[model samples]
Target chain A: MNSHLILRTVSKFLIPLIVVYGLYVHFHGDFGPGGGFQAGVIVAAAVVLYALIFGLDACKVAVPPSWIRIGMTTGVLLYVGTGVVTWLLGGAFLDYDVLRNNPDHPAGQHLGIILVELGVLFTVATVMVAIFYAFGSRTPDISDEDW
Target chain B: MLNLINAAAAQAGNVPPTLIIDICLMAMLVVVAFAIVRIRSLFAIVMLQGVYSLLSAAWFVSLDAVDVAFTESAVGAGISTVLMLSAMLLTDRKSAPVPVKKALGPLMVCVLAGAAMFYAIPDMPAFGDPDSPANTGPGMEYMTASVKQVEVPNVVTAVLASYRGYDTMAETVVIFMAGLGVLLLLGLNGNAGFWQAKVQGQNICTQAAPRARILTSPSDKPNTEPRAPGDPEPSSKNTSVKKVAAKKTAARKTAAKKPATKRTTSKKAAKKPAKPKGEAS
Candidate 1:
């Protein structure tokens, strides 16, 4: 059917746009309706879209399990590490005030928020993909006729 | 229409036009939810669930919880549907209808719980009540402080990332654990021999017909390998390079009885297994 061809062509076109939009949402959270959580899911949806079109095997080839694991770990570490850094800087745990030099400017809060959100982006994106992989991989070999 | 005028008036904050949009969305949601309950096909149910999620996401946006709306659509409608479809492949497509007797207890519980919630609704603050405790409490402090101290234009991000950092971190940990649980239940390889998977495996998930992929796309197969020609095709044109255990072996057992020839019928027996080797190894 032309539907298959359309899906393939459309997905190829849409994947990059989705990923970029996800990044936009990630960075633009401060001024608009977004955050790391939403951004991460959007980015993962791109990968999921890729998987749906190209097949899960090809999808996994593009993003391996090991890389997914690293992403999840890095996201959590980056988040807590910022907290630990703040603690080391002599503020209460997760206090963003110590992140900047000048007390007058909200620079510390700004930096801390960005870093923490980045961490959330990392974890949320990888976890969603990882969950997808787990489910996708475990599937039995069902053909199109099964429907 | 008068309704359009009412909607516009509501937007100007004088008339609270919650009923128009909210009623339409809620009615659709209820219908979809009921349809999902009655549907015998798991596939249809999954699709309906996505519809429900989208409806709810739109409702969330109407309620001014744009952030929540964003998540509900993506995670709930987008990813969850895909995940459910994949998971469904492993099970029977049609769900067995539940016995009325067996369903009664849960149905009663649901009705009672819904009744209790409805009764409690009167005590709850009206939507967007500025005098409400939630709006006036430390939540107000977070909002005001975010502008002056955090300087972030969107207070939601400021609250989630800064003021409620620990809560967000805990939520992240919870997500991480959910991933962990799925990984434990289903190996990323989805193969029986988890250890057998090579360091540079071509595919992790055997989603579609495994061997069919290699046949359809020649460039994807490593031409250097002499075994490409001998790789057991699914006979019926299924795909996957990973050795799916059940069907292939049964097919090979029959093929093993037939003499090994390089024809389509002689798929399984050509190699070592008397039957065709399901994998390249």
Candidate 2:
């Protein structure tokens, strides 16, 4: 992979754009055709591309396995925490309206969606990365000649 | 002939453009599917599957299901392809040939399922019909009130994240559980140390102890051991060896100064390699 100058240079150029696009899709999801799930996948694809061009160890060093594991758990916690907070605010579980002081407020809904989407983004991205790490870390039992 | 064609085009108006795109995409999808079935190489099949996903995403875009299209393109075409390739690295590239007799039962089941679905299709309501239950149900309410109620322009997001928040939460939890399951099954042994050992053709204990030793190995002793067979010669290995050596020396010096630090360092050194040794074959 290090010998392939073309791939390394081209990927270095493309990775940033891909990541930026993923973030754009994430934050602009409310007004656009993308959301947390799509954006998360896009971001993960960027990391995977980097892994493909570079190596798995390099990718792991860039985004550590432990951090990804933590991120996976944190995302679920964030999603459930939002629900719990709303419940504690004297509303039903996942009732975003009660998040704000004014019941039936659009602000509360907006905030709730943003938080939930963020949670989704975290879980999706980390899970995909973790899966990649798992698969990438293994030694291929077969060789190219076998194929 | 040109005049007749122009007249027909004028008559058809906006419908032809979309219909043409739809037909083209569907034809490509069918071709890709056939290729997938005909090909014995798992690599080519994985690539064709990604192509299929992209084609379907294009179709979804034409149908105005842009969000679904985005997801199909990113997850189905992109991440899944990479994941499949990664998994492929562990398995054989060529699929084992199936005997005709062995395949017949599965083929019959597939045909039966396809026929059943086709038979049910005509009973369904027309696509995008206003009177259809989907359009007339809560979807209508979401479309009408979501902007004002949720202040989000994307009604789908508003509905998913706010109105039907519980369902979305459940979906997230499901994804989390999947990650947890994979981690539980694969994560512990899926580290560089495990693979390094597997590559070197050494027993697990010998491999594990060396890594701990490498971490605590004196800086003065250069890693003069011959490179493993088939391992690539890269400069990064030299740098990494030096870095590891430096850290180990620093740790040793600190341990000499403080017996308390020595106990903690020794405990960590003992624990780190022990876990991997227990799991490694």
DockQ winner among the candidates?
1
Task: Rate residue A11 of model 1 by lDDT.
Answer: 90
Two-chain complex of model 1, DockQ on C-alpha atoms against the true structure: 0.51
For candidate 1, what is the DockQ-based docking class? medium
Backbone clash pairs for candidate 2 read none
**Model 2 chain B: which ten-residue window has the lowest total lDDT?**
B272-281
- Per model, the share of native interface contacts recovered reads 0.70, 0.65
Worst 10 residues of 1 chain A by lDDT: A138-147
Q: Estimated TM-score per prediction?
A: 0.76, 0.74
lDDT digits (tens) for residues A89-134 of candidate 1: 9998999889887868878988898889888999999989988776
Task: State how far residue B252 of model 2 sits from its true place (Å).
Answer: 23
> Which candidate number has the best lDDT?
1
